[model samples]
Target: MAGGSFRKSLGYALAGLAYTLRTQPNMRFHFGAALVVVAVALLLGVGVRDLLIILFAIALVVIAEMFNTAVETVVDLYTAKYHPLARVAKDVAAGAVLLAALNSVVVGLLVFYPYLHAFVRFWARSWRGGN
Candidate 1:
């Protein structure tokens, strides 16, 4: 890394990201979820602040997942046997992903609840023949 060209470093980073996307199902799922969330937010006309918060939450979850994958890969590389420490390392990494995912869910609910609530109310009124 030291003395490496900036472009070369960027290329390496991009290659790692591509490898992760190609190999990790969880990463793919996160990307798909992110796309859906962003599309919905746009359709709902979410305010800029809330949209930024949503994006941050999405990034946090994806970054945590990537870190978890890295930790698992390193642990597996270091030990093939079932060691207690390896188990602990993997579990801790997984817990990070879970926490990030939970945070994203909370953020999503907070940001989207108002829009969805109004939409549902309008839908109900229409169904009941109310203005």
Candidate 2:
């Protein structure tokens, strides 16, 4: 095999995605979180531009997570036993994911905070008998 055709490459990419979803707990969690974020944005009727930003933020986190998983897997393959450089590599990859996650949180807050506040206020008013 001199390499795969485009369709085969796409299938292989999907297989890699499935493998990550299956084997990586954090990947699963990130995907779940992304789903929730998208759902909330839809419910809140986010503007198109904000929706795009939210999508970008979610993608960044997921992409970072995938990259981090790749780095960890390659590092482990390189060495079974503990190694300082492997630890460093894993830690740095994890840090990249952390940064992405944090950035997503910031974007979410920027986009959703006012809507969340309005939601809370509406609920509060309803609970207080429209006072």
Candidate 3:
């Protein structure tokens, strides 16, 4: 029973991912940004802790965008015409995504800035040493 339930949950999660990929432009952008972050972290030789932080931030932004998309879709389904409260609901959902994306940006900068700085400094020192 537990095994069956786990499989069902996994299937549902995959379906949700598929839906987002099919319908959401923002999801695509977030996914592309996530790939860039991962590549940057790898190039910078970020440690395990930094990688975890980066992953968490990426996940946070993606999840928030997914939730925002869901809310907007539901609102549109319920109302064919313009309504102030429906607009407010959609706006609030978008705001949530914006806030989460901002937080992710802060997290990425905080976690990676030192590594980036050190990389630049190392290159500068090596160039000077070579000269």
Candidate 4:
């Protein structure tokens, strides 16, 4: 087919997502982490703009990981034997994932710090029998 129908295209895209979730451990971990982050943000009552920023950060990390997986898969398909160029390609992709993950961590900390601090202070006061 030159170009599939929109529904067919969506199906194919979903299949790829399923395949990635099924086959990639890192993807699963990212998904789990994303769920936790979202839950915590909601619990902390993060503002809409900050929540959106956190979501974007999470998406960036996941997208980077998916791209890294694609690069590794393609490199493996291209050469079974060790090659410097293939190694470089895989390493670069991994670096991108690392950077994205780091960015997400920074965003999470920045977004959640004040909320967490207040939560801790409130709990501490309760423990000390303070009003």
Poorest stretch of ten by lDDT in candidate 1: 1-10
- Per-residue lDDT of candidate 1, residues 36-117 (tens digit): 9999999988999999999999999988988998999999999999999999999999999999999999999999999999
Error of 1 at 71 (Å): 0.6
TM for every model, in the order presented, reads 0.91, 0.88, 0.92, 0.93
lDDT tens digits, residues 7-98, model 2? 79989889888988999999999999999999999998888999999999999988888889899999989999999999999999999999
Ranking by lDDT: 1, 4, 2, 3
Could you tell me the lDDT of residue 101 within candidate 4? 97
Please tell me which predicted candidate would have the highest lDDT against the true structure. 1
Decoy 1 TM-score against native: 0.91
Candidate 3 C-alpha error for residue 86, in Å: 0.7
lDDT of model 3, residue 46:
97
Q: Model 3: residues >4 Å from true position, as ranges?
A: none
Worst 10 residues of 3 by lDDT: 122-131
- Compared with the true structure, the alpha-carbon lDDT of candidate 1 equals 0.94
**Candidate scoring better on lDDT of 2 and 4:** 4
Query: What lDDT tens digits, residue by residue, belong to model 4 across residues 1-131?
Result: 64568779899878878888999999999999999999999998999999999999999998898889889999999999999999999999999999999999999999999999999999999999996
Runs in model 4 lying further than 4 Å from the true structure: 1-4
